[model samples]
Target: MIPNSGIAITIDIGDEHFIHAPKKKEVADRLLFNALNQTYGYNTVDYAAPIFNSQEKKNGGIVLKFKNAETGLYSYEKLNGFEIAGEDKVFYPAKAKIVGRKDVFVISDDVPNPVAVRYAWRNWVVGTLYNAMLLPTSSFRTDNWDDAIKAKK
Candidate 1:
């Protein structure tokens, strides 16, 4: 998860007031981060955990199960780059969609008997999945293959 924090300023004016600032989006984002981190005392609001524990092969695809899903399972704003691998251990681009259950998703690339699934598992890609809290899921892979990127580094 992206580390963030917030700051709280007290004014002796003794009244609640709304302050609007005309700033760039990124500037506003930074301010919001600091405000949230300072107010919530870190790692409390909109926190996400990577803990997918179950996977199943079905309908020429892979099904990922997220247990104890709070805020209803959902995807992010942009297209999520998903990859799937079969027994041959070669990953291919795939797409993810929420299936019957809120905590279940079907990732499909049409690979027969898919064995593994990953989401936004790249150095720079938009994440597509989130929980009810609107916290983005970190890049992750279900395979245990030698990390080529790590090896190169």
Candidate 2:
């Protein structure tokens, strides 16, 4: 940070007097901005992308669909943490997929059969949802799964 041109508000606390000035970015920020500019296809990656559903109806309510602003789901290896729910609202973690362009199908693995599925249910989870490029997938919750917050709380 630099001092304001000519006159400005100045104050002295305990250690030293402070002068208002034009804000300047730190080196780390400059480095990141530079990296983003130089990095290959940076726009294609989203760290915390948002997920929105399409109003157009499809196969059925089961046809829960959304768009990944990015090209595709990132897969350092394989994406995971998909889960399912029945009418009872029981959520059991299951397998998932990136079909076609943006649709992700969360299959009922443990439950064998299911009605609805949720992805990345945990808050502040490290990583799970992402395009094949490893960009973080949008955070979401499938069901108010019974006891969803109860157990965690």
Candidate 3:
């Protein structure tokens, strides 16, 4: 599980022993350094991916604010994997951009009165949002309401 605090890593040893991979030590070392730098407060390291902070409705879209994006927020190429939903509880793909240091503006022509937003909410999602530190953003949803994606089917 991904914790709110601490660091994480992905490892694959195939059919070999757990620590047999040549890169295992390297990966573990990196993870330890990140934990010490980011979690232990060794000069503000942006270790984990950005998580949802807050959001507000703007003129035609929603402005999403983040906390762990101290350096700034970013996206790979153009923004993707964002969706906006209205009171009808239906969601549509949205156009999003980093507006400032830690804010992102998401808009969807299909969702005029958007009441909720979600990012990388799919099981097979390829996350695009990132912080200035180059870490990817975690999957998040704005509300606890029923999932619009599930309702579609």
Clashing residue pairs in all predictions, respectively, total 10, 9, 0
Across 1-153, the per-residue lDDT of candidate 1 in tens digits comes to 445443221111112333432334534454565556555666455433334767877777877776435546676453357777777776777777766535544455446677887776664554566666544455667787884222111
Q: Model 3, range 77-105, lDDT digits (tens) per residue?
A: 88888889988888788899989668999
Residue 146 of model 3 has an lDDT of 64
What's the TM-score of each model vs. the native? 0.60, 0.51, 0.76
The TM-score measured for candidate 3 stands at 0.76
RMSD in order of candidates: 10.8, 13.1, 5.6
Q: Which ten residues in a row have the lowest lDDT in candidate 1?
A: 7-16
Q: Report lDDT (Cα) of residue 85, candidate 3.
A: 90
44-77: candidate 2 lDDT, tens digit per residue: 3333233646322223223346654346554544
Best by lDDT: 3
